[model samples]
Target: MTVYATFDSPLGELLLVGEESATAVGGTALVSLSLPGQKGAAEVRDGWRLAPEEFEEITAQLRAYFAGELTCFSIEFARGAGTDFQRRVWRAVEEIPYGRTATYGQIAERVGSAGAGVRAVGTAIGRNPLLVVRPCHRVIGADGALRGYAGGLPSKERLLGLEGALVP
Candidate 1:
């Protein structure tokens, strides 16, 4: 079974989900992520419990990321299972950097499956459970516009600004 911990973050409350080995998931500001047609709203409280290693490792990286001193993160995680196409899209998302951005079309090209299209890639991005750790905020619209972010645009803007990439 999957175990979880909840914690407060700059973005709001967060859920840190894990398996036996390591911290596998980190989702922040979960209030708006409530699934549509679900039974009830999702709620998080302060100082929730987590595995010792997961609490230690992921929280440290998250702190560093917020402080702007860390760019890339190395965390032990299980990607679990996904379709080959979803894996390809996630791999491309991993390639996006701290202060840089990529468009959906560009990600489609990078993955190299004909007719896979931006919409398919977007779907994969939406399914990414890792959130800030994976830096999906780095993906943008074709004209350099801020686009849909699973974590929301304000959070995206905050992340980009923290990375020194947000334009005036």
Candidate 2:
């Protein structure tokens, strides 16, 4: 069964969806992290529960991240919807360090695709379900300009600024 929770952060409201893990020993693997205005709205699904307490660790980590004290997210994340190529792109995005940025071209290359794959990489990024936790905001335009984000360009800029990648 899946459970979800809502938490407030510097970037605004976040929705965490996951299911209790049987193998992890008192752990839940996150399935998705949707931003303030994104889908995955707060509702009790048939096999889902609204359990905020079950996500205390994740909330604490996110709070520390917003406060600049956490650089890595350790919560286990379950695989979300995506194609194999998109999953490869998402993994590449995860490798982008905190307070740094990468271009779509770079990500495409990292995923072992041809020069024309930049657009494909961007499309995969656009579909990323984990948002900030996967660090999709760290992907910028080739010319060093902020680009599209699931949470909007303004939110993208704000996140980069908070991470010290861009001056506030």
Candidate 3:
């Protein structure tokens, strides 16, 4: 069964989608973490259960992250959440360390994609279902420009700034 909960963060209201999982911190595996006004944001659909209690651990971790008390997330993702290629890109994104950024071309190379595949990498990043928890916001342009973010560029800047990744 699908379950969901909303979280009010410094960025805005966030929609968290997940499912029961024996190995996850909260007995749930996150499927998606979307910000307010995000593209392709998840909505509360019929047959989905609203279970705020199920997200206690997630919210606590998020609170710690926003407070700069936590750097890495221990939450688990639902199995088989994306295509193999997309999963590859997402895994590369997950490797991006906290308070640092990487270019799309770099991620493509990390995934064994040629320079020509930078655009494809950007597309895959754009379609990433898990946002902050997956750390897609840390992917920047080769020119050091903050590029497209599912949560919007302003949110991207805020996140980078919060992480001390932004240059003065």
Number of the top-ranking candidate, with TM-score as the measure? 3
Q: Give candidate 3 misplaced runs (Cα > 4 Å).
A: none
- lDDT for predicted candidate 1 compared with the true structure: 0.67
lDDT (Cα, tens digit) per residue for candidate 3, span 21-55? 88888788899899999998989999999998889
Clashes of each: 0, 0, 0
RMSD in angstroms, all models? Answer: 5.6, 2.1, 1.0
Give the poorly placed runs of model 2, Cα more than 4 Å off: 39-46
Q: List TM-scores for all candidates, in order.
A: 0.78, 0.91, 0.97
lDDT of each: 0.67, 0.84, 0.92
lDDT: worst 10-residue window of model 1:
29-38
Which of the two, 1 or 2, has more TM-score?
2
Clashing residue pairs, backbone N/CA/C < 3 A, model 2: none
Score candidate 2 by TM-score against the native: 0.91
Tens digits of lDDT, candidate 1, 1-168: 344555566777666655554233343221122221212323434444444354565677777888777899876555554578887888898898888888888998899853558888888877766677777788887788888776677887887888877543
